[model samples]
Target: MTDVAVPPPAPTTQTRARAEVAVAGVRVAPPVRRQAGAGPSDDGHVRLDGRGAALPLDPSSPFEVVDGRLLRDGDDVGLEVEAVDRPRFYDLATADGVPYEQLARLHGTDVLASTVIQTCIRYGEDDRCRFCAIESSLRAGATTRVKTPPQLAEVAEAAVRLDGVRQVVLTTGTTATPDRGARYLARCVAAIRRAVPGLPVQVQCEPPDDLAVLSELSMVGATSIGIHVESLDDEVRRRWMPGKAHVPLDDYWRAWDAAVRTFGRNQVSTYLLVGLGEDPDELVAGASELVARGVYPFVVPFRPLVGTLAADHPAPDPAVLAEVTERVAAVLRAAGMRGADQGAGCAACGACSVLSTAGG
Candidate 1:
C-alpha cells in the first residue's frame, strides 16, 4: 500500500498490450496482428483506425470519448484505442418481438450491461443526475422501454454462448419504492442465472429504503451490487443529483453496510465520480472512508456524455484525474481490494476509471 511514484513515459509495447487486453477492442486488441497507425492533426488530435482519435492530456478539455483513454498534446501517449465489433447476439430477437441486444449491450469482451428499466423516476432536468442519459437510448429506440425477465434470459443466454460474455451488469432508473429498483433487478438476475447458470451478475440501483433487499439480491444469485453515491459532499450531491440528494448520506451508509454484510467485503461498491466541483482532497478522504467501511470506491472521471445535462460542460483535467486516481489507488491497495477481484460491476471491468492502472 506504500505510495510509489512512477514517472510518466510514452506508451510502450507492453503497456499497449495490457491496454488492449483491458479494453478488449478489435482495433486495439485484435486477435490477428494489425498495424497501429497514427496521424497528427493541427488541432492536436491523432487519428487511429476504427478507434477514435486521441485528445490532448490537459484536464481542462471538455472533449473526451466513451473509452477511458486519455489524450495529451496530440500525441497518443497513455491512450489506447480499441474498436469493439458488434456482437452476433445483436441480430437476434425474442419471440415477443423484443430485440435480444436491447436487453443488454456488450462492454469489452466479457461484460454485458443493461439499463434494466429504461424509464427513470427522476428524468426531469431538476432532479436528474447531470451525467445520466438513462432514457436517451430508449427515446432513440435503441432499447426497449422495459425488458421482461424472459426477454432478458433469452438475450443473456445468447450473449454468453455467442460472444463469450462472462459477467452481467443490471442497472435501473430509480423507481418509487422502498426497495427502489432492487426487486425488478432481483427478478432479472434470477431469470438470467436460470438461463445461464454460473454467470456472475451485478445489480446497480439507488440505496433502497429496505436494507434487507441486499440479502434478496444475494439470494437471487447476484454476485455483486453497486449503490452509486456519486459524491459524498452534500452540496455536490444536491447540485449534481438533486433527486438522489434528498436521500440522506446516512441512507447510503446504512445500505452499503447492509450490502457488505450480505454480499461480503469487496462485493459492495459505489461510484465516486470526479469533476463535480468537489475538492480533490474530499474525494480522496471519502474514498478512504469507503475503503475502511469495506466498500470499494469506483473512482471514475465525469465525462459529459452526449444527451446528458453535462454534455456541454467540460470534464476534469487529465492531470486531475491522474492525481485522484493515484490517491484512490493507494486506499484500495491498502484495503486489499482490486477492481478485477470484485467479480462483477464497473469496478471489476474498470474501463471507465484510470485507477485500475495504479492497481485499484
Candidate 2:
C-alpha cells in the first residue's frame, strides 16, 4: 500500500470540508502528540497528508505549519498537511525495559496502534464509554497497562524497521476473559505473525462469547476485525454504553455473523458513532443494515475527549458531520465498500473517517 500516486479524490464538497476541518479545528502550531484510546477522537494527532489524507486534527487547531503546508487564517488549504511524526519506535526501549512509547503507538500515517488491554471490564464510571478516553492514557503515565506477546513482537520489529510501519492495530479492554479478550488476542496475533513477516494485523475485540473467538482471530495473524458497536440505538446503547449496553444486539448479530464468516466480506468492521444521541435517520437506517450485513459502518464523529464523560461536550455538528458523511458515504457506496478496500484495521486506516475521502 505504498507505491504512492494517489490524488484524484477531494470534492465530495471538498471531502466534506476536509472532514469538517478534521472535526472543526485549525489553530495549530505546536503540542500535537495525542491519540487517546479505543480509537476515534482527534482532539490532537493523526493528520497525515501527502495526497493520501489521514485526518484527526484539533489539538488546538488553527492549522499552522505554513511553509511545509496547511495554513489557515492565512488561507492555503492547498493540501500538504502535517502532524503525524513521533515514531522511530519512539526512541526505542523494550528488552523488558518498556517505553517503546509504552508498547506501541504510531497510528495513522503508518498505523502501529495498540491498547492491548489497557484495562476495562467496562472500566467503571458506571461502566465507561461515555466517549471513552480509555484510561486517559493509562491515567496519564502515557501508556502501558499490559502489552506482552513478546512485548508485541518487540514492538512489531521496531515498528516495521523504524517507522515504515504499514499495519497492525490490536485494540482491547473488555477483559473478564471468556475469550472475550479473544484468547489474549490470539496470543497477540501469534506474536505479531512470528515477529513481523507479512505484517497486516487488526484485532479490536468485544464480541467474543466464543464463536471460536472469530476463528481464533483468523487462525492467528488476524488481518482484520473490529466489532465496535458504538451506537445502534437501543436507546443509544442504553444511554451511552452502560457496560456496552448490556451486550445483546443479538450479541451484535451474533458477532456480525461470526465476523462475516471469519473476516471475509469487507473484512468485518463496525463503529458507528456520529453524535450518539442518534437518529440521523436512525444513523442512516442503522448504517444501511450494517451495509447489508457485510458490516463496515465505521461512521465516526463524536469527539469530546479530555478524560471523557463527554469532555466538555460539543464537536459533532460540522453540519451534522456533513449530513452523517453523506449518509454514510452512500452506505459505503452501495456496499462495494472501501476503507482502502480492507486488508488491515480501522476500515483499513481511513484515519478516523472521511470514509476514505468520501468515496467510501
Candidate 3:
C-alpha cells in the first residue's frame, strides 16, 4: 500500500472536525439530499453551527447527530447539525405536469439551483471529468435533458413565491458551439430576471470563446458568474478533466478577467477542488493569484460520488483539507474577499466547502 502523506495539523478543533466529517461523512440522513449531478456531488444539506453545510451521509462514519449537535464516538463535537426542511415549492408542478422538482432543486436552505442543459459533449468516458456525474441524473430520469427559459422562469417565480428562495444558480453542460452554452444561459438569466426582478442569480458555465457573452449575462441580470476550472494545475486538469483541459488555462484566465470586468471584483468565482494529486502549496499560491485578480477561488474537498470515474478514489486527508482551506481562507481574507460577498451562487450559498467556516 502506498503511504498516505500526513497533512499538517488543522488550525482549530472546529476546522479539524469539519475536515474530518467532510471526508468521513456523518451517519445522519438529511431531508434534502443531492445524489448525483453537476457537483459537489453526493451529499445531504444541513446547517453546521447555523451555517449551511453539504455533508455526505456515510453509514460507516463515526459521526452522528443527536440532540441537534454533531457527535463522534459518543462525544459532542461542538457542531450543530440541523437538516434543511424540504421546500414548499417542491410540491408544485408545471401546467404540462412536469414536476417542479424536475426543474430545479433547493441547495442549502434557500438557494434554488438547476443544470439548464443536463447533457454534455464531453461526457464520454475518455474525455469526462473523472469526478463529474453531470449526466447520471439525466439518465436516471431525475431531471430533463433541456429546460426552456419559460419553464425555468415559471419555476423560479413559484419558488420565490412559495418557498421564499433567496437566490438562484443556473449551470449547464458544456456544448459544442463557440459560446459553449453561455448564450443559452444568458437567455435563461433574462427570463428568470424578468420573472423575478432583482432576485440575485448566479450563472455558471465553461469559458466561452466569445468573452462578450460575459457582459451580456451581467447586463441581463446575472448577479455573479462562476467559470469553474476545478483545478489550476495543467497536469491535474489533463488527467482528470481531459476535455476541459483542452480549453487551456489561458482561456480560463481570459474568461476570468473578462468576467471580473463585467461582474466586478469578488463577484466572479471558480472552483478550486482539493485532492486530485495537485501540490497543496502550489494550489494555495494559484488561489492567491486568483484573489489578486479579483476572482474568488471557492475551495472545496473532492468527493468521490457513486457515478463517476473517480468513484473509488479516496477523499483528501482531513488535516490536509483543513490546512489547505485555512491557507486559502487567509489569502481571501487578506484580499477582503469572502464568498458571501459574491451575493449568489455556490460561494454565497457556502455549503459545499468549509472555506466559509474558515472565514473566507
In terms of TM-score, the best-performing candidate is 3
Question: What is the per-residue lDDT of model 3 for residues 117-224, given as tens digits with 9 covering 90 to 100?
Answer: 999999998899999998999989899999999999999999899888999999999999999999999999999999999999999999999899888998899999
Tens-digit lDDT string for candidate 2 (1-360): 012222223246566566667676555533335566765564444454543344444556555557667666667766666666667788888765778887777756777888888888887888787888877888887887888899888888888988798888888888887777888888988998998878999888888777877887788879888889888778878888889889988888888878988788778888888877786776777777777778788887887776678777777776676667776776678668877888888788776777766667
Ranking of all predicted structures according to TM-score, beginning with the best and ending with the worst: 3, 1, 2
Local distance difference test, per candidate? 0.71, 0.75, 0.90
The top-ranked prediction according to lDDT is: 3
Q: Tell me the deviation in Å of residue 62 in model 3.
A: 1.1
Model 2: ten consecutive residues of lowest lDDT? 1-10
Clashing pairs in 1: 56-71, 56-72, 57-71, 57-72, 59-317, 59-318
TM-score of each: 0.81, 0.33, 0.97
Better model by TM-score: candidate 2 vs candidate 3:
3
lDDT of 2: 0.75
Clashing residue pairs in candidate 3 (N, C-alpha, C atoms within 3 angstroms): none
Off by over 4 Å in 3: 1-10
Candidate 3 TM-score versus the reference: 0.97
